[model samples]
Target: MQKKQSEWKWQWTKVYDDSKWLFTEWIYPNKLKDFKGKTVLDCGCGCGQHLNFVAPYCKQVTGIDLNTPRIAKKNTRQHKNVKVVEGDIAKIRLKKKFDIVYSIGVLHHTDNPSKSFNNIKKMVKKKGKLIVWVYSYEGNFLNRTAVEFLKKHILLRLNKNFLWVISNITAALMYIPIYTIYLLPLRFLPFYQYFQNWRKLGFKRNNQNVFDKLNAPQTFFIKKSTVKKWFNPKEFAKVHISHYKGVSWRGSGVLK
Candidate 1:
């Protein structure tokens, strides 16, 4: 876990961007208006990008991360309502719970995702909302097989500097297919909707996206069944779990 933490710190230091549209995609059914005047916690807030979006509407927003929070603090310094802190989502427990708690694209990266999910849920106030997004196992067959093989055997063993260069090259190579073949009306294709979202971003952000996937020290492609198990009916109500872009899962529930 220490080694994985170090990899994330190095990754965050290299890339920073606020994908507002991507945020919307991940936080659906729970709109930005849902956060109005509410206390919010971004369980694994990286660089405070998402915090920037929510701080304006929320009564108070706290962004917590496992890595050093220097970038998050700096990025959110202008927002008086925002606080950035260093903490492990799988271990740390603050004194107070929040009206809305979210962990976007973070839990799957943790060493113990279920433990982390349980820990983060404890931070949600009774009747408050808990939202999470994770890589889905159902539609990520390519990622789970070929990509996973390369990552585990080759990419993970490369030097950070070299890997960044490789990521840049890979992103450039992908730009062609993304704009050409991906533009076709082929809903049956894998990652068709996911690639559509990527087309909206520029080259720089796309490169950052590529680097992020390659730089992660570890990751878990969660199943829909596992996501269902996390939101037990005895503990939660109004639970909504949906597949996102056929490549991921977005789930939200009201704590009981």
Candidate 2:
């Protein structure tokens, strides 16, 4: 089972305090203009950071995850008007559908993103919205190689005791480029852009036992065309691709 089930929840519950850019950059700006009075659903609402951002704008917000402890831990956030439930985002049964149903960096981890997303679609009222930001295959050869290596080998081989250690080390190292650029302003620097958002992946690493949970078999990838086509049949008008564009398709759309 993915560690996100139990171990991950207990291990990495309080990681959403920061990472505002991740939530805002990926899915927020594109979909949020319509959110002021909407009912929104955040699937795989990890530490509730993104949920926290969206909660105030919507009529009511519901966050669902498979990990019970994580849900309880988020109660510590004491976010009013936001309900945290322990359930599979992919298999949730809700009485009320939403005006917006979205997942951020979540679908890729599912055994079948298609089924999970389609299930998400069922939760949205007609003409509602769906937004998702997934892993991107867009980039240079070396960058892709390194990311694939870490996902395939390093993470899978990590044991519990050393998992957190590895996450810390990696997370710290990812900041080096940021600091280097900050300390020295250069028009052109190697790995500058690559490391700019390095904190996003690093944040994922810094939290709990995520190094183990990131080892999901389905995390590999999907093409942009494939994802676009999948949603097209379901009344979703293609929105835009963010993370996985050019190489793969991590996109957002509105259900028509």
Candidate 3:
């Protein structure tokens, strides 16, 4: 777990310049309006990118990360209503609850994602909201097998400079299929929706995305049933979960 945190801290330091809102729109498309005047918390906030999008409408927002708290603080320093703190989602317990709490593309990388989810859910006040997005096990066979094998056996063992070069080469090669075959009418293509989303990003972001995937020390693809179990029907007034873009699960609920 410490290695995971150290790996992520190094990863964020390498790509700290990216200012894009990446998954904010996809993860919370119809939910931004709910953030207005609300106190929000971004668990595992990376360099505070999502905080930039939420701070404008939120009354106040606090971001916590196990690794990049300093970077997150500096990145979101422009927002007077934002606070960045160092903490692990699986263990940290704050004194106050939030109107909205979210973790995007972060929990799945934790050593104990289930524990992290349960711990963070406690931070949401009764009648407040909670949202999370994580890699889904049902649709990610390649990631679970081939990608996992490569990262653990090969990519992770390589020196950072060599791994960086490989990431660049891989991202460049991916552009060929993304622009050509991906634009076709073949909806059967693996990760069709995910690839389409990637088409909108620039080369730098694409490289960063590739590097992130290759450098990550570990990943866990959560099952749909597992995600369902996380949101207790009795505790949540309403809950929604979907297989997001065929590669991940997006879930949200209003606390009762």
| Candidate of highest lDDT | 1
| Residue-by-residue lDDT tens digits, candidate 2, 176-242 | 6567664466635544444544544545534432343343334646556656765675587746655
Q: Write candidate 3's Cα lDDT for 1-256 as tens digits.
A: 4343567777777785343455565465446778899999999998788888889889999998988899898888999999998888888989999999999888998888999999999999999999999899987888899989999989988888888899999999998988999899898888888897788778888898789889888899999999998887988867888887798888888999
Q: Per-residue lDDT tens digits of candidate 1, residues 44-152?
A: 9988889999898999999998785888999889999999888889988799999999999999988889999999999999999999999999899998898878888
Is 2 or 3 the stronger prediction by lDDT?
Answer: 3
> Candidate 2 overall Cα lDDT vs. reference?
0.63
Output the lDDT of residue 197, model 2: 49
* Local error of candidate 1 at residue 193 (angstroms): 1.4
> What TM-score, over all chains together, does every model reach?
0.95, 0.75, 0.94
Error of 2 at 33 (Å): 4.7
RMSD of each: 1.4, 4.4, 1.8
Please state the error at residue 250 of candidate 3 in Å.
0.8
Q: lDDT values of the candidates?
A: 0.89, 0.63, 0.86
